[model samples]
Target chain A: MDKPKKSALIQKDGVSISEITNKNSIENLKNKRKSEMDPNELVDSILNKDITALSRAITLIESKNPKHLKAANTILKGCLPHANKSVRIGITGIPGVGKSSFIETFGNHLTKLGKRVAVLAIDPSSSVSRGSILGDKTRMEDLVKNDNAYIRPSASGDSLGGVARKTRETITLCEAAGFNIIIIETVGVGQSETTVHSMVDFFLLLKLAGAGDELQGIKRGIIEMADLIAINKADGDNLKAAKLAKTEFTRALHLYPKKSSNWNPKVTVCSATENTGIDKIWSMVLDYVEITTKNAYFIKKRNEQNKYWLLQTIETQLKFYFFNQPKIKKELKNQLQLIENNKTTPFAAADYLLNL
Target chain B: MDKPKKSALIQKDGVSISEITNKNSIENLKNKRKSEMDPNELVDSILNKDITALSRAITLIESKNPKHLKAANTILKGCLPHANKSVRIGITGIPGVGKSSFIETFGNHLTKLGKRVAVLAIDPSSSVSRGSILGDKTRMEDLVKNDNAYIRPSASGDSLGGVARKTRETITLCEAAGFNIIIIETVGVGQSETTVHSMVDFFLLLKLAGAGDELQGIKRGIIEMADLIAINKADGDNLKAAKLAKTEFTRALHLYPKKSSNWNPKVTVCSATENTGIDKIWSMVLDYVEITTKNAYFIKKRNEQNKYWLLQTIETQLKFYFFNQPKIKKELKNQLQLIENNKTTPFAAADYLLNL
Candidate 1:
């Protein structure tokens, strides 16, 4: 497809082939642009690490324009073989844990290694408010401006459940765009945390060292799930308390069963502000990938997480679709009446309404 | 309605009504039991606080015997007027909170004050593997021996949420039976807690003082919904820790804007084990009821809860029914297959299946 024809096609995104056929004046238009790109050209631009093309490509996939989606998928297919192979890390912590600042420092560290890094953050608070602050891009300005680094703030929409309608697909797009070392940052280790954790290769939990008492510690469930627990903000007056917290956390971690990775969950202290200790953390992660990948466990982990997302997404959709049926819409009211009047138990009412 | 006819109906439980209606012939066979009590007599015995009659009346409702259910409903009708007049308290904590022991001590206190107490405990877990443990009778032996006390475990079934399905209905039965105070005991504040809370005037959250930190104390959402937070096991050395927990909770409570009740939430320290401060807790609850009832909030709340249950039950059944639709069932497999292959997003797949 040539530039001029592509520009014209972009302007009229909805003109399908059937529509084009009806309008013979644009006969050569389909041949000129074709609504699909050469896979080799896509790979060339992506390998050059063109962030603009990557952004536009991701936008195309997200768009409802069927032609644009087809073009985007074609681009992704062409870029597939050349896509960068990098570690996909998932980061999560409770609110007030300075997630953005930490990610900025972490991304900067990765970029310094001559590696291309992509940060995909899904902020829970953003999904609710329609317009998320997109603060991470602003926070990681230096990293974002770096030639090898890409930062895309969460897509603003109503899609919840850590993995959005476009998130997993977006991950694929990011990979095809030749970026390696993908870091998925999610705020809060609650429901949304579960979402990111299922997508990433290694899950890291960050905890604030609040006065170091055993009373102030991460939740047991979240802690147990972590591949590594990093005590964030280990500087100044917090230094002593952070040490105490590290000791307590190490003891508590020992009580949990060994992980499938055969690597015990390690705890470390890091100061994102000071840019200290990030190298050690990176080394630890590298060790995890090396061990797991060699043993064939890394691929198994990805496959399992993929399986979970497939099942979870399907179940959620089924629930949404099931409640919106027309016949059910009518039967529900009659059944509620019967239930209220004691004519039927709720379970039997459910049974009857289901039959209807 | 008479003795011989009722006996014949009872004997041929699953038999046709024709067998029960052969009254003229059956009358001659059981003329001797005419000396036993009639419906009015049984009702009178239950009203006069006869424990055995109350038990039998509840059994009648549980039984499918037409004569017994008819008698039970009639007895319930008489109790309806008296039911709402009692303080319905729902107590729930984690399992192994010594719930039965707590209720026993609490019940004994009420009975000693000449209050007629009725215990309706619903154990959802017990319904499947074991019969429901009507622990009040077994544990509160002193109170059980009282003529004015009634003890019944959940007979409803798997979903304690079916909750005393007849529970609210049976409150009338117990009330008609002359028990002025109703105590509903559940395993804990969880999915079932919301169900029990809907049925009671006051919902109490009992906590093991040192078991959880303030942050870990049931998510803020549940805490905000709580009317009163009582720090149980506040006796002995745990008292200091409990006090700290109370302070932490009090602070956390403030984070939730003042509730619509116009009443500030209060946290109390108590040891249900030593039976200490039981009266104080009751006084606090009575004050809540008095103020809310006098302000006309009580009835409105009950009405809202009933409406909520009706809607929730309807929605749940609607989902179940729609998914089980023959056409929907056949297409779900294909749509899910598309979703698994990434041909369509889960949302899009659901939309297609639902449209079909």
Candidate 2:
């Protein structure tokens, strides 16, 4: 049969409709395949600063499937050489302390300085709450739209250790993707702050100004972990309270022992809404890097952190293997009962289980 | 022939000299055997409140020999039923904070109140320092001489976990031996305070008045763990400073979040030298017990602590087994080198080692 003549309304273009659709589908298929790229190709794409490749690599790292884990490890090994080049800053605060706003403002500031920034969250509670702190990109609208910024919500896992490992591996992928500054965000309510603190070069604690009670709601060990405490919402009516809180924190920080970094913890007032004090915070980070790097503590601390993560990962996996064993699952309940009955001490029970 | 050579001055009233000498030697041998009693015999003696048997049992628990470990486990199982009966109080202070004197005074006070007091130390540094904090019985001369008090020096061990286990086991033996009060002493420095804090019903931090610097030299988490902070050496000229410190600490303690036990940590000035305020400290402990028990937090906390120790022991053992393997020992070194050379991520290295 002869082909139907083209209607006057359907003006002929240089390319035929069939050719155009075929070419479009082929390109779409190529992109789909690239999303599921081999480990080496993913690494190559990540190294060439491909954010999609980095995200896919992180998905592989976060996968529960054993096959995906194997691929993730291969990609991780490829990325390791390029990792450790970025400065990882841990940011934490209570739920309403403007974490997202602070991150948005700070991340934009970082990008403006000709830097690539990656923001990762570690809210292990997200699994239970089903509402991750960073799950909504609308919270950081401007930074989300920035080409130099990448944001990943908290990865849900059965335990903080599992989530920590996924986030840690994602950091390596982001670093390989040429992100020079990585911000690890966590809520201050749980042990997530500690996990983030262990992985970061500098830890920033965001605080809200309370009525003359600066340290009232601060969690223990958090201030000690913080390299900087930024009292947010220091605009309009809250500015005075934030300044007072900064003074109180400064006085409180002096009570802590001299940090091994030989750098004093600094307290500052910031207004994420007004986008004020963000530059000073970045300058402080630069100052910290300059001092720590000059004294060799930066490299030393990174090395120690690497060793910490190595041992921590091993210990976590060891526990996972032990507690998940079917024999242990059954015997542990029996042992706990024995403990409750006062028939066996925890030490003795531990011995019995270890023997088993 | 020697019996025949006895002069009139050596004449026996009702027995021969040879018989008396034989009787004395037999008694000495029996006492020696008691010191080296078997596990069952040790358990019997400990139940009867025999101090020597308790000492021997603790020695076995501290020994590095596998045979001793077996004996210790047997003794631990025997004593397990009787453990958790005593009020275990953990005392910690810096080197010059008068921990020894304070413990001596507090122990004597406890004994005077008709409470059988057992003192155990957990100074892991003693292994290297060759100077355990409680090594010299002369430090607590009055308490050592008191029939109602027992003092044992810290058990030297290669690791804090080893020392902690030994001390924990010793506490069981002490409780089994009918001691109603157990005091665990550790230096304020390092992780020993945390170890001691974990294994006690109450944690007391001893401090000195440091020229208006109330919190100076205080470790980060120590204050948070403390159920009470005693300003020691509050006599003569130091009395005013001690009171000042008490006020500052009271204010500082207010900054911490409410403890899980729902008890406010108290601060007081005490003179270990003058023996004043000792009774008040004991009264405070009783008050703590009354409140926590009323709320059932006392038993609840102990149960949680038991679970903590159980999991901690298992984790420590797991790491020990994994790290001590000849294959792991060698591969770990290789993996560390790979980490240093940026050839592997910590998670990947952990996976490799875990698979092996």
Candidate 3:
């Protein structure tokens, strides 16, 4: 078969393919220009509260270039002391639950209180396609150009571990740049929420009221991990329904075992668009931080999380190294075959590999 | 700081410690004599339904003796075909929830229908000191004396992994002995319930009515894993409370995401002491099996479990070997110190170790 004409093949809605290609190329060049900076200079500029330098450092951390590894580490080390001074919060909800609007409203509220707010996202799927819904700046129209708010889209990468690592490092950079409140937003998808939950001090789960189908798709484990659940879009027609949902969620929360942190998980109603009940949620977060800090659980939990990340990183790297080795990979295949055939026990195979 | 006399130091209650020690020695000698048979002899004897031989085979599997390793593997291979024909069930509940009585009633119900039943326990805490409450066979008086029922206490081992492995192997031996029903019981104190749930075809959680304190201790993860939750000891004064609890639980379960297995978790009330609802519970199990078998989920789940255990066993053994090495252990301690001091990133430490 003869190939179709290049113009006809790539044409969509009568626009030429080269026009789209050139536009994307120009955007890529602009991003490339924005990220060009030495590690030491980047750190100095970020500490001086230069947002451009902070953004460049985050891009450096997310880069896969082998040369960027050392630079990323250097910038991260310089930012460590300034980090952890902020109250980091994780916000999550399924798609169509108004996560972007909620963040925009909540972030605007924080900025109104003279707080510098930084919003980051942990979306693993974006790593694959680089076309994440949140990648569009227009999604959060109100907060896009706010001087006190910094909204960064999810970093693009191939693996969740890589994305998570970059996001964690970016948090420190944001903190060092004088951001007092860092809000890590993630869509309630797979393991991304859990990853965000671990890195944040307070985890807020957003939900829409009067959606029975919503309850059936939300895992109980996620609900149990939530520190606060807000019934969102609680305005006009959704007012009574949101109140009813709030009561139902409160009863459900009562059944969960009390958290070791001794903080009760709360459920409240909110209207992000209308900006109702936003202050109550902020006060709830403040109350939690005050109580947990007074009891020393705040420091204890952060210390434990730090240790956990260390062990987790080591475990993941060790497995990756082991499986990536040519000899070990071949042996692993053989061992799995043996296990499938029940010719040798899993323990015996593992023993043989360890000895080798 | 002088020590007391040896006899007085070890004495408990009114009995001298030496007398108890001598009695235990005699019992050990008897058990040693019983387990001295060869691998082939033990397999033949177990296949012939000799309870003593079956017990000895299980002991061989649980033994740390190097000599028992080959024999255990040989016996397990011989029994592989006989396993997978039985329906394995997992039962769990917090202490004081009448787990013993519930199992006794349920076991009797199956045996009365001409099915031989095998009961095993996975108590990691018992392995630490062998003083677990389930270590007492006297607690299950009814099942202990029943000819068609075999009750085995938790295997005494140092870790949950060791106990889980032994219990899994014991299931095969019981199947070879022609027991068509196998019930693995665990306490819902920690991760043991999850381990047992992974190995069983059906998981049942026991609870007492009118005990809000009970709900406060039971983790939501455990409830989410339960195929059925039974409100036990629901008789006379507790009947109304049990009914109310059942309604509450059912409502709570409705909010959870439906399981991929397409089975909705069921909540019911029962009186193990009065032997009420025993048949109904058995019927529920039968119904589950019937439906899952027709949909091929029964075999699919078991096959998936088999593969899961194989991978899990390998992963556990690999970690154990890596951590137990003197060189690795020393280096790990040093790396952990560096992590605590914030002198090294987790990825950097892990990379160094992997290269080593």
The C-alpha RMSD of each candidate to the native structure, in angstroms, is 12.4, 9.4, 7.7
DockQ for model 1 equals 0.10
Better of 1 and 3 by TM-score: 3
lDDT of each: 0.68, 0.87, 0.82
- For candidate 3, lDDT tens digit of each residue in B238-328? 9999999999899988877788778888999999999998888889899888988888888788766766776676667656766787988
Clashing pairs in 3: none
Q: In model 1, which residue pairs have backbone atoms overlapping below 3 Å?
A: A354-B321, B79-B176, B160-B163, B164-B167
Supply the global lDDT for candidate 3: 0.82
DockQ of 3: 0.25
What is the i-RMS of every prediction? 6.6, 2.6, 3.4
**For model 1, how big is the CA root-mean-square deviation?**
12.4
TM-score of each: 0.70, 0.82, 0.82
Native contacts kept (model 1):
0.07
- Once fitted onto the true fold, the runs of candidate 2 whose alpha carbons sit more than 4 angstroms away are A1-44, A65-67, A95-97, A207-216, A229-276, A290-296, A340-342, B1-37, B95-97, B207-216, B229-270, B291-296
Give model 2's clash tally: 0
Ranking by DockQ: 2, 3, 1
